[model samples]
Target: MVAAALAICLRQRGLNVGVMKPVETGVGERGSTLSDAEYLRAAGGAVDPVDAIGPYRLAAPLAPLAAARQAGTVIEMDRILTAYERLAAGHTLMVVEGIGGGLVPIGHHFNVRDLIARLGLPTVVVGRATLGGVNHALLTVEALRQRRIAILGIVLNHTAIPSGPSGKGPDAIATRQGDSTVELVKELSGVPVLGPLRHEPMLAQAWEAGLGKVAAEDAIRTLADLIMQDVP
Candidate 1:
């Protein structure tokens, strides 16, 4: 969700947002629940075909390289770029969600960082808002920098509720962890940091509807404004 919510926020701002996952693993066949790409496309209000939204759907719940190999396929950066071009053709902006992390291998030698460099689009790194967020977020920023990829900012998303010892109130440990993660990442990231967005349990059950609930939050709106600043 941070990605899906960002897409919705962009759409709400009147940007014709095109979303892509490019590669998705752990997909169930013909399920009631939508895949990540589907949820993103729906949230972004993109009319692009699902094929364009996600060119590779792997069955195994593994990293891209391993999943593609298990599926007897190789993820071609060119293929993904082609699909991206198709989606970007009509939309004013595109939101391409990265799988795993920047160092994740997609093919024999190419990684997500390579793909991002090839796409030539600025990125927004998303990391967990719980403990260890600082390490993950900083590693990603440095990894992308190694490829000279433009990073717009960082977003620390709250994927789980950090319950305190009492495990009662919403603000228990969640507030402290969120605040610490956000501040640490911001101070050290060398880029803007947004969110640690409130945990929305409904997101897991209802992707689109759950995102609709927080699409207008201060962080999402601030991130959208930051993105729009680069819109020439």
Candidate 2:
């Protein structure tokens, strides 16, 4: 959803942007399902072919390696790289979304970290803005740094509503923990905390509306501007 939101924000700025998912698992039922790549393409107004947007589409809804194994296919890194090059040649900027986390295995002996290193693109790590988010964000940042990936920044995405069933906002515990998570992730990772995005329920509404509703908010615009500043 963050990827889609970012794509929308970039498009609103009149940039020729393209979105790619590289590898997608958990494809929904045929003829009625839109994958992440599809949503991104629509959101970014991308003209690239579907194959270029997502090189590998797996059905098992697992890690790429496991999903490919279940389907009796192997993920070839060169294939993905070739597709990326082809897609990159056509766009001024490309927003490539990775599957799962940094350590996720895309193929035998190759992980998301390896893919990022190979692509040689600056990355913006996205994590949930909830309890325990600090640990997850910091750990992912550490792993990326260890692999020498250029991290542009971090985006703490608020994916859930702060209010609970009782019609009250987040409890004291959650609020305190979330605040600490944002501060600590920046301090520990030594990367700019690009900005915090408020939960945009419009995303789901847009999806349900068949991508007709392009959700744009202040947070999305802010993050988009930060990304543009980071882009060389």
Candidate 3:
């Protein structure tokens, strides 16, 4: 969702942006199977084919390698690179979304970290803004830093609304936890916290509607601009 929203925001600024999700898993049986790639295409107004946007679409909802093995295929890194080069050449910028987490396996000898290193693109780590978020974010930052991957920043996305008394909305505890997660991630990772998007069910609804730039919220646009600021 963050990837799609960011792509839309970048396009709104009149930049010729493209989107890619090199490997996708957990595909559904009906309707827009390659959901993430589709969303990105809509948001960025990309004209690339689905194969270019997502070179590998696995049926199983598992890690890339496992999914590929289950489907009796192997992930071809060269193909992904070729597709990416094509998209990069056609656009001023390309938003490439990574699957799962940094350590996820894309092939037998390669992982998401290796792929990022190969592409030489800075990363924006998206994580949940909730209890225990700080630990997860810091671990991800450390892993990326270990590989010397340039990290653009961190985005703490609120995936769910915190329920309060009478279940009205986020309670004080949830708010404090979210705030602390953002601060600690920044202080520990030495990476800027670009956004702590407040929980909004409407964003999901918008994504379901069309996943276009028109569905992106103002906060998403601000986050997108911040990402561009860090780009060379």
Candidate 4:
């Protein structure tokens, strides 16, 4: 979803963009069955082929190491780096969404942070702007810093906020005034907040009406603009 959103956002700005999911699992059709590469192809107007975009396709929905272990396959770190290079070649910017959280294991000997460090890309954390979000986002930042990864910024994704009382909806409303994501982010410090994302009506409506493609491009473009604002 992040990849698709980013693609739509960047495409709107008329920039060529690519996405890399070094390890993917539990994909089916109806978009759910789709591989990360396929999602990029559908959401990213000018996407590379699936094989060229994503080189590792695991079979389960668990951690890559666990999944690979179950399948009796090895998750190669060098292969991931090579795949990333293949997807990144000739592109001004590439959005690489790691599987699971920042600490999730990718191979027997490495995790997401290792990938980030090896890639040497400025890191941005995409998080839910909800109750526990501050904790999760902060911990993520701290962990990355501990690993010596350059922390870029935090993008609190409002789209993933829970709606009920269990969620941060009440808090977000009280603070954000039901307007922008910026208000919800003033609660944190350290990293630059970048901006908040309002749920795009066109996107929801398109998905609900079974016409996601109608607004997919526009949404991708909008997100791309937001991402560009923070690029150094």
Worst 10 residues of 1 by lDDT: 162-171
lDDT tens digits, residue span 1-232, model 1:
7788889998877888889999999888546777888888788887788878999988888999999888999989889999989888988989899999898999998998999999999998888887788899999999889888998888777766645676675656666776798889989999988876777888777766778988977888898998899877
**How far off is model 1, as Cα RMSD?**
1.9
Global fold similarity of model 2 (TM-score):
0.89
Runs in model 3 deviating more than 4 A are 29-34, 208-219, 230-232
The model with the greater lDDT, 1 or 4, is 1
What is candidate 4's lDDT per residue for 36-144, written digit by digit as tens?
Answer: 6676766666557787677877667677888888779998989888878877785767878777778999888889888999998877777766556667777888899
Best by lDDT: 1
For residues 1-232, write the lDDT of model 3, one tens digit per residue. Answer: 7788778678778889989999998877445544677777877899998878988987888889999999999897888899999999999899999999999999988999989999999898989888899988999999999999998788887756557988776788888888888788878878778667656555445554444533366556666766678556
Candidate 2 lDDT over residue span 6-48, tens digit each: 7877877777888899999988735576888888888889878
Best-performing candidate as measured by TM-score: 1
Models ranked on TM-score: 1, 3, 2, 4
Q: Where is model 1 more than 4 Å wrong at Cα?
A: 29-31, 170-177
| Deviation of model 4 at 38, angstroms | 1.3
- Write the candidate numbers in order of decreasing lDDT: 1, 3, 2, 4
TM-scores of the models, in the order given: 0.92, 0.89, 0.89, 0.75
- Residue pairs in clash, model 1: none
Which has the higher TM-score value, candidate number 2 or candidate number 3? 3
